[model samples]
Target: MLDKNVNLEGKNILVTGAAGFIGSNLVLELLKTLKSVNIVGIDSVNDYYDVKIKEWRLEELEKEAKTHKDSTWKFVKGNIADRGLIDSIFAKFKPAVVVNLAAQAGVRYSIINPDAYIEANIIGFYNILEACRHSYDNGEKGVEHLVYASSSSVYGTNKKVPYSTDDKVDNPVSLYAATKKSNELMAHAYSKLYNIPSTGLRFFTVYGPAGRPDMAYFGFTNKLIKGENIQIFNYGNCKRDFTYVDDIVEGIKHVMQSAPARKNGEDGLPIPPYAVYNIGNSNPENLLDFVTILQEELVRAEVLPRDYDFELHKKLVPMQQGDVPVTYADTTALERNFGFKPSTDLRTGLRKFAEWYKEFYKV
Candidate 1:
């Protein structure tokens, strides 16, 4: 409960992965809401999904930057795993708040390439922690808050209905999940040792317009438009807490304003100022139901014809390796603390994605 507050006005904020889906949306909101703020964004611009979507997000950020009278935006194309690059950025910006959203993102991809997860999610996050540590040199009040992304996948194969922060996340089913859990552990250590006020957000299934094309909703739309069959894993029996990207961004924005307070133990050592919360839609939707809504939305947006044979184009298959049957988040902690919960329904989120897909692809 380190009670630290950041004034976005006249402050420098650094957002890693700023060109990514949630990062870009966050930048736009900051530029729109706060005045006299300087935002520095860095991303590797990797072709994990489509570089075009990242570029499009950056384009939208630039548009918002131009319209703001007092807010400024800077984009640096680089990887967070590079210690020198991360250090240099911190040295130059001396940002009061650091949001580390950059990481190797997919579970299935991690199975194909486990090294990427270690390099980006683990090593990259280590570099971020190191930079935050050094930011406090010379008694400077550096990095009032260090907010980073965690994942609901950390609660691997839990029989629990609603995954909670209080649950033990020792079992990780994927390399990606392992790396994310490692991040929370590492952040806790850093917060304990260096007294870094840190918050880790475990995000559930995030989807929205201009979202990652690898996501099921976006990929389904793409495949359906091309008349290619879309595979529904686990015979379409899985459930997920499909949180809208905007809701995720909103949660991050609210969390950034407050940092854990440093408290001293009886021995006079500062207790670790660390916190973690689940940011997700409380309602879990079945995979088949989610796809059904996606199909309807696709037709409504004219991405698919009204008579499109969704059944014929959907292939029910066994669950892939490194995947869980469900991801239902308990957002009670986030709501209790931040007075906010993700309320965006799956249909509303998928509809926006469908509309964006049609417009972006000119389908």
Candidate 2:
């Protein structure tokens, strides 16, 4: 098992996409765990879903920041793809640790707007790599670790049940998946070239309260509330390793502390200090079953009437483009290294989301 060696106390940490679901939750976790930590968060706060939710998350972060006497949180509104903005932020903060969570998310959206994916996931990630490289220009032991997000989509219709880090992931069906895979390649090159310790986490179907509204779980609820039928793609013959947001955050927190050790090759060259792991529940829940649980939770939370017609609100449809039938994560590497794995079940996670939805939307 890798040992946790990085000390976060009094250290400057930068989190891109800080107002987004994962980034905001991460900031809150850091404030709770570490004292005297300086957190710098940057986000474009785009209207990919509901901007209100992003603002709400930022509000929560601000509230949490105030509770910690020694810890301070600063929010910057900017795009990661803007090289000048990224450079300026790095120069000012001089963060020792960076968590890059900013990217144009969604599988279907990638088809509609491929440019957005390239600009944000490709160009944006390149800017981050360049910043990390330049941080060492002044002989400063800069950027102890760079942790970024990858996705389960990289598996790309694999026959394998449990998606493993060791599994071959060359086939990416969607532009979004391709970009995520590209990020891993880019990180590896930067790590090998600059000797930067970096890790990439392939998160699987992460959902929770205040999650991206584009996600199926949240979208379905909205459709049901509006008396519109929600599409169940692939004729409801799908399974997802639905990891809760908190569980994903826990995995990230542990990985941030345990970066790959820098090692030198016998040929007098630095071996790439890069690692990637899957952060998921490892339990694949059937789509129809998942919806059943979600509907029950929605009714239990009073977001829907007890007599709500679930069957009437669902439309089973053929498989969509760029979508796989199942996503089952092989988290052996995560468990072996971090001594942790996502354990939250589907019912429990969906219930929390239902309750949060009721309160947030005043349903």
Candidate 3:
């Protein structure tokens, strides 16, 4: 395993999308793990799903912060797309590690709201790159590592069993996928030009308690709770590498400590200092089976009645416009470099979600 180069303890770290599912979890993990660390978070807290959920996450962070007396937490309510605000935060915080997780996330939503994708995914990311590039001014130690979120959607509909980082991702099937692909390209350019050590993580279908409501597992739960039919896309043939939120956060924490080493090639210039990796379970679960597990978990958690008619609430439907058949991740490189891989099984992960949902919704 590659040796860790950046130590997170006693450092100022900036995490965008602070109120988000993955972001909030990451922040909590950092506070719990590191002593004497300062974290600055930024989020628009838009009403994309439920603002109350976002607020609840922030409240959790507040509670977590109280226990870690040596650590400091500051949150800014704003958008990363706002250049002035982003620049000001970077200038003030001067974070040693920057994690960018703010973006328009849904594939289907991107179909109708392409502008949000471009504005947040494209322009917002560009602003981040610019800020990172400028952070090294006056021979100051700038961002040691820049880690951002990418999606498995970048693979499109490749027939390959397991997607690899070395595989071609030039063909993106959805606008959301295209934007994520664009983020990889933009980061690569900044890394090459400014010698920023940047890493992009291609996450599979990430789900858990307090997750994004637009995701299949969460959405299906909501619809089933209300007695509405939940559509099983691709006629129940679709498969996904459903990764748990805690596993994803663990991978991120590992990556944050180890940035790509900066070195000069034969040309006497920087070697881009860039890398990308896939963080997934490497085990794909069929949609129908996934739904069945989710249903059983809900019943076990008392979120749904044991006698609820699940058959009446599930509908098999054709593939949506911006969806792929399957997504499997090849995590060989991740394990080789970090000695870590996501191992959370569907039943275990779904059980946590069901329990959390039961408590959160007062079922």
Instruction: Give Cα-based local distance difference scores for all models.
Output: 0.91, 0.94, 0.96
Choose 1 or 3, whichever is better by lDDT: 3
Top-scoring candidate (lDDT): 3
Candidate 2 weakest ten by summed lDDT: 3-12
The C-alpha local distance difference test score for the whole of candidate 2 amounts to 0.94
Show the lowest summed lDDT stretch of 10 residues, model 1: 1-10
Candidate 1 per-residue lDDT over residues 1-363, each given as its tens digit: 322276668889999999899899999989988878999999999988889989999999998899987788999999999999999999999999999999989899998988888988999999999999999999898999999999999999999879999999999999999999999999999999999999999999999999988888888888887899999999999998999999999999889988888788899998999999999898999999989899998889888889998889989999999999999999888888888989988888888888888888888
Model 1 lDDT at residue 334: 88
> How many residue pairs clash (N, CA or C atoms closer than 3 angstroms) in each of the candidate models, in the order given?
5, 0, 0
Question: Residue 99 lDDT in model 2?
Answer: 99
Q: For residues 1-363, what per-residue lDDT tens digits would candidate 3 score against the true structure? A: 988999999999999999999999999999998978999999999999999899999999999999988999999999889999999999999999999999999999998989999999999999999999999999989999999999999999998879999999999999999999999999999999999999999999999999999999999999999999999999999999999999999999999999999999999999999999999999999999999999999999999999999999889999999899999999999999999999999999999999999999999
Best first by lDDT, ranked: 3, 2, 1
Candidate 3: the clashing residue pairs are none
Q: Which regions of candidate 3 deviate over 4 angstroms? A: none
RMSD of each: 1.2, 0.7, 0.6
Per-model TM against the reference: 0.98, 0.99, 0.99
